[model samples]
Target: MFNKLDLSKELTGRRALVTGGTRGIGAAIAQRLLDAGAKVVVAARTRSDDTPAAATFVAGDVSTSEGVEAVATQALAALGGLDILVNNAGGGRAFLEGSWTIPDKAWHDSFALNLFAAIRLTNAVLPALRASKAAAVVNISSAAATMPFGPFAHYGAAKAALEYYSRTLAMELAPSGIRVNVVSPGVISTPGSDEFARTTPGFSTDDWTRNIPLGRLGATEDIAEVVALLVSGRGKFLTGANYRVDGGMTAR
Candidate 1:
């Protein structure tokens, strides 16, 4: 069993960078790392009031090549070097009409944010990751990847690609002592999701929760805690694995 109290300094002396770390799930991950005693730098297109105060903030969009380069450069500069990386930035709007209605731009944007960003940022930071004796990378995916739904086809497809990429990356980096893993969250309650719920016609949180074995939506901290464990010494042996923190929703 994992004990939160015992993990206060589990990541002491570690330096971390979390993409999309300004709010929601990304913000929670950054805060968890900071609480675990790691020097954290968060990268996003803009800083918000919710950005963690203790974490250094770098402004850059992960969805573009130029933005990826800028974020990687600035985050490394702020943290000096990186021991951990959490690719926690990803989202997409539901195309209620049908898959046919999802525009080319939507597909392109989805892939850019959910798949390419992680790949590009990792490549950019490969050198720093190689230098760390205990480096770990966690890519945030969505349960939608495996449980495909019509409205979320593009987002799901992109996340599915991310999972495939993460597995390949883990194998390639293993010999170099860099661990790579994926975390897929199910129906997480965040500001983004709340907005999605409000705007999405006929979308009901209660209906969604009924399908969850845990009988509730997941909190950002729920995902963050799992990520913290994966990057800590306790999970040194774990890599190339996908952890579904979805309150057992995927089990069914």
Candidate 2:
């Protein structure tokens, strides 16, 4: 049955750029794309040795304008061009509840990381995406965008904005043969999730996993497979779609 999925046929000859591809969901997406025969370039603030075969790595922070530009430049040089742009670099810790003590600076910082970073990077790669046969952009969103977990008010708001941005960009770029979409994932078991569990009081992994009807929290691969499909020809007719890969968390 696994062989029958035929995922590989969908991505031959494609070139992709995955931000934050050195770890977690981004790393999983890079591996899936490579398995499907795409040449993948990964960009992140740090480097990792676990990169898939034939993958190129570029170092830069994608949250700032300068960082986004540096990554785009390096990715283009490494991959020769970009056909798929996976905006998987955004993340932050604005989900913790704190009324007056949180400070306004924290809010802005969260948006800079989780929202502006994707916007800036996508903007930098528009021209290249336009030139490819399968021009697609996949923005990694969060279930919190709509679910409204109070702990992460800022994070949720930023993710909501990201969803809006991706849909609007889809409308504007469709005429140019480019597709844009979002993948909103639930709590996945990653190093980041482990860190969050450790820091956030009462937010145990068990607590989060219980919300998933699938009986367990999602893995990075669960999100990555969906992303690969969206950027592939198999997902050609899909755009402006926000898919919630949350193991049924949103269903309830």
Candidate 3:
């Protein structure tokens, strides 16, 4: 049996689900967990040719009722029951002028995708989570929730809500041996982020690095490492926390 001093196998025999796990930060998180010895299930609306081979793929959208149902059913069946759930399926659509020019549908869609999907998926898996001896739920938020740059205002707003909801989930689920937390990543250099940086007015990849205290853009693995820790036995005492893996972006 492994003990706390053993870093090599903290999550052995665990079963996990990661939404949007086919690409970007989500893919990195899925890979990290697999490395930690967890049985991983990756959920996405579509399959990618580059999707990690170690994970079992469950194609479905997490933003809709039917999609959520599909992912939940598939995950439960595949994993038997889930010991970890990562809500990583949310992102932004570039709409210039943000709050000033964005349409109602954009705001609603943002909430549906970023906030409500987590809520629905979490609710769907609660029973299984309760049954587990040790369980965790990690919701992927953004630095924008606190930093609040306007171009992705709706995304930020939705993520802010998710952070709040995640804390409450922690409080309610703690008694049942389930820990819920939030991971807010800053400007990571993913394909989607690279393009967003290049096109979003004054922002550029170089400029973003200059502003960050780390003097570099973050990699998807940077965020993944933190998530891997949070879902493992090392995080047994942690719950209701919003972890910012932002390279000190918010410290300034």
TM, every model = 0.97, 0.94, 0.96
Candidate 3, 152-245: lDDT as tens digits:
8998999999999999989988888899989999889998889887777877998889879999989999999999889887788999999999
Please give the TM-score that candidate 1 achieves against the real structure.
0.97
Model 3: how far residue 9 lies from native, Å = 2.5
What lDDT is obtained when candidate 3 is compared to the true structure?
0.90
Question: Model 1: how far is 153 from its true place, Å?
Answer: 0.6
Per-residue alpha-carbon lDDT of candidate 2 for residues 1-252, written as tens digits (9 for 90 to 100): 445766665687889999989889999999999989898999988787656557899988887899999999999998889899999987766445553455688788878988999999888988898888779999999988988666677788889999999999999999998999999998888888888888878788888888889989899999999998899877889999999999999989
Error of 3 at 203 (Å): 2.4
On TM-score, the stronger of 1 and 2 is 1
What would the per-residue lDDT of candidate 1 be over residues 3-109, giving only the tens digit for each residue?
Answer: 64468888999999999999999999999999999999999999998899999999898999999999999988888899999999899989998888999999999
Write down the lDDT of every candidate, Cα atoms only. Answer: 0.94, 0.87, 0.90
Count of backbone clashes for each model?
0, 2, 0
- On the 0 to 100 scale, the lDDT of residue 84 in model 3 is 95
The alpha-carbon deviation from the true structure for residue 148 of candidate 3, after best TM-score superposition, in angstroms, is 2.5
What residue pairs are clashing in model 1?
Answer: none
RMSD of each: 1.5, 2.1, 1.7
Span of ten consecutive residues with least summed lDDT in model 3? 1-10
